[model samples]
Target chain A: MAKQFGLLARFKDTPDLFHAAEKVRDAGYRKWDTFAPLPIHGLPAAQGLGRSRVPVFTLIGGFCGFWIGLLMVWYMNLYDYPLLVGGMPFFSPIFPFPIAYELTILLAAFGTLIGMFVMNTLPQHYHPLFNSEQFLATSSDQFMIAIESSDPQFNTEATRLFLEEIGGTDIQVIEE
Target chain B: MATTTSNLPTCPAQAELLDQIRPAEHKETPLVGNKRDFPWVTEKICTIVESRVPTWWWVAFAMALFTASFTGVGLVWLVSTGVGVWGLANPVNWGWAIVNFVFWIGIGHAGTLISAILCLLKQGWRTSINRAAEAMTIFAVVCAGIFPLFHVGRVWFAWWLFPIPNSNAIWPQFRSPLEWDVFAVSTYGTVSALFWYMGMIPDLGTLRDRATLVLRRGMDETLTPLQRKVQTAIWTLRKYGYGIFAMGWRNAGNHWRNYEMAYLLLAGLSTPLVLSVHTIVSFDFAVSIIPGWHTTIFPPYFVAGAIFSGFGMVLTLMLPLRALYGFHDLITQRHIDNMCKICLGTGCIVGYAYIMEFFIAWYGANPFEEFAFINRAFGQYAWAYWIMFSCNVFVPQLFWFKAVRRNAAMVWIMSILINVGMWFERFVITVTSLANDFLPTSWGYYSPTIVDIFTFFGTFGLFSVLFLLFLKVLPIMPMGEVKFVMPQADPHGHGFGDTAQGANSEMKGGAH
Candidate 1:
């Protein structure tokens, strides 16, 4: 038989896809993924994806915004020009609080949006997962797991045995 | 393939149902008795609209409107005739005008806070009355604007507040508290208008669909053409308007994520305005060397008082509105519970401020400050002070009990009481303190003339007229948001999954 580049395994149910993907991962194959119409919990671990770092980015953005506001206040009222109103300090932190709060939030939001876009590697026109018609079920109602031949551990006989052991049904191999 | 095909059979059927085109013949008339058991929502909603305003609502609005318009018409006469027609004397420059200004502005706060703040927290109960509350905010702000504009006496020169370099080559004093007022109020109006419009767009589409030919024609003129106008409008909106604002929403895809971002942004934006607006308003009092006004606690105190009065007004508006509009489901006991909690919290803060003011007056050991507090409670104008205490402090205490908080009738009564109390609190601050300043010889009693009273009335009338118009025009609830918040619409744990994967995969991979 001709060598296939990818093995496709449809799930008995959504949960089966996750279990099969987990087995594939434990078998030490990295070039494997699980796809479903909706997000399946714990599938990220099954697919070797890590947790997000967007929150840290947001915190940094917020900090930057706070300092920027403080800097503006200092520039406008203290360094650039100074006016004494009611004998209060030129760079009063009390009045600067609202501006600082606003800027912090603004920066945090911008960071979140940008961070999300950058992390997701989005706006791409094409993906390998889009190649198979059977895989189109990933956008509708079915769950599917695909293990590419790119994996170091992916041998045709061994992968087929691994998928069948983990409750994968309607399995097939595909090539480019 | 050993997979059972039975479970998968339904998918194709659903897909066929989705793709099947309904004939236009049945479009104009929905099958009348298709689901005979489903209670008639159309009739119910119509009955709600035609129902008389609750007796209490009319009485309350009439009384409040009388007072509001009295103050309003009084200001008009002040402008038309002269400021001298009113009771503002020297040293006591800020009088009922300041009192009304603060009072109305304070009432405005609860509306936005209820709408935006509660929405952010996912307190779903806010949907029903948020429209009315937002409308109240706009109206109260308008009423608040009248006093300050006429306070200058030369009302026509209001344009000078703008940053217009004039023939006199004069620019507004950027440092002045009044100038800050100009900025705060205008910014607030613009932001509120945008928020309100954004909220109304989807509901407006819903209303457009259900409207009669005349109403449809009217809405179509502004929105789009009639016939298939609403369908076209909604489709376009769902495709484009929601395309951008929806933030990569696909169906209910990432609905909550987008809402969370937009809502967080709004809350983050408005929270500052809440603090800044009142702080700037307080500056008008503080910049003056009035011993009582020149206190550091003024900002927090004013903010607390604004929130206190604002929630009070919201309760006052909501109690009747739910009954009138048949919105009991949307504005539930839980919403009232939260609002009552706010009122209780803010009331305590105001009460604490009152105590702190007296303590500080004694601590400062300044006779002017001491006498101001003393005279406020025990002097000739002590009536206003007691009314403030009883209304602001004592009345809100009823909310401590779950029963009282949940009880609509009692909520209405307390809300009105709080409004009265807040108004009197402003009265005590503006009139009593200014009237009895450091110089005993310069001290004078300031009673509002009929013109002052009339201007106040006219303002209430104006507010009511505007409110009535709003009811007729806009959808009272945000329909799009309602669909978004429903349990069926929640796709992922946080509405961030495949939708996020497609649009934001690059960002999600970032190391930071």
Candidate 2:
């Protein structure tokens, strides 16, 4: 038999989900989360999460791309093999501006994707939550709150009762 | 859970009181119709992919595949023979190949404009159409790439355009406008693809779950054994296919937080990137000393024209799909009206550029420049020029009327004509200037061979084939994003406060 993973509770709709998350948060549980079909605007705040850390990665990638584009052009046109075209200078930022500018955007986009994947630790491809039939609805219509057994606050019976108290229906102790 | 009707003004006097306070103008057009909910939105979009192949899709796919074969034949012949197989000549060296390239690349811009620019501007309407539009951008870029790649004569030597350490000792010439185009087009394609895929992750998860749930819930007694077997096979394939790409998206709070931020950052990067693509494409001409192509207005003019043609292409693809899918509610009339307005605005800009170019030619008083402008409108290629003017400039003027804008059939026709006009636009610019250059002895009238004509037409077939496959497999709308904009998604909205059911639900998040 699969070991018990956590207690999963179903909320009726977005408002029910939102309020349940707030109650769960204030109740001092750490290893818990609310899942829904679409992003609720204030759910992150309710869940005690702050601003995402993706921008720093984007900034870093942009700077590197900008410099790399500029230097690559300089090396190719000026330093590596010098040539003159239409009596234009060996290189000017003006001519290579498009390349550098494009690279800035290109790498910045790459950074955002990378940062997101890293922050989310995605391509995980497996989690205990995947085992629950009810939890599958998170991407479609269902809204849910799951409290992991690993949390210090977890007690199967107590968590089930708490979830029910907070207007959660169909509470179940899902297993991995 | 049950705040369905009580939140509304139930009686006339109650409605009158509510209306007195509710600003009539404050009511934004609903993004979705029939007061849809999350599950319905997901089901509506997902079923398009999950449903058995429709008859029309089969018919369209057959035509697209048949048409795509011409491109395959043309390319094989071009490469096996030489560049001279086509109608490209000494004077008009850049002929239909360059014209088609610019036209297709111009069509690619609307996708990014809708996905990136509109997203940044908080235009909730973009959510319904952005998925298909982004797919169009990708397929259009693929078609755009084929021309320049084969136009180099030896398609094998195309790798030399990249700044890589190859057996060939030299690197790409960074100073060339063509080289700039390489980076610009490739970057735009990559970012647009990334944005499209990332945006679809949540929706892919939705499909994945549908496969799991539907498969688990056994079918009705109506299905035969063979039918059940086939359905099971498809569901299994879809489960793994979507599940793999979905990357185990849980719709968890932490995931959405980062996903949205990443999306915003990408949109920010793409806005400037989309503008830069056409601007750089314009530089390909403006940097050259050609009389017609040397104007400073080329960048802005080209961008506006690209947007006009892109919106035109969007309408061409969307009008049919929306009607076929019965997606009238999702793709509302407001979306069509908004797109028409954009076309009219940009068409005026393109027309102004056309007239302004002639004015500049007269103002500069250069005989060569003057001849180029005169030749475009009144010389050997006058027919092409007039076609461009009428289609791009004159036809789109119909959009100025609200009635015409609301009429999807009229708008669809205008959109196709806009596409045709823009194609001729590139033709007039590329051919007329080269056909009658400063030296008379080198001047020659350019016309495409059957190979050139077939290759260009084949691209449409290829685009349709790709898009058809996309429609058959992928969720065609950004279901997650669409739902995000619905009034019900707002936790602080009327449904969440001051109602009996809202109180029953204990909506504490609204307090935050």
**Top-scoring candidate (TM-score):** 2
lDDT of 1 by residue, B124-243 (tens): 566656777888888899889888888887989889887555676554444567766776776666566656654553343222223222233343345445645665554444334322
DockQ for every model comes to: 0.04, 0.57
Residue A160, candidate 1: Cα error in Å is 31
lDDT, residue B129, model 1: 64
iRMS, model 2 (angstroms) = 5.0
Question: How accurate locally is residue B98 in candidate 2, as Cα lDDT from 0 to 100?
Answer: 92
Which stretch of 10 consecutive residues in model 2 chain B shows the poorest summed lDDT? B503-512
Please list the residue runs of candidate 2 whose C-alpha ends up more than 4 Å from where it truly belongs after superposition: B1-25, B218-227, B495-512
Chain B, per-candidate TM-score = 0.76, 0.91
Best by DockQ: 2
Clash tally, candidates in order:
39, 0
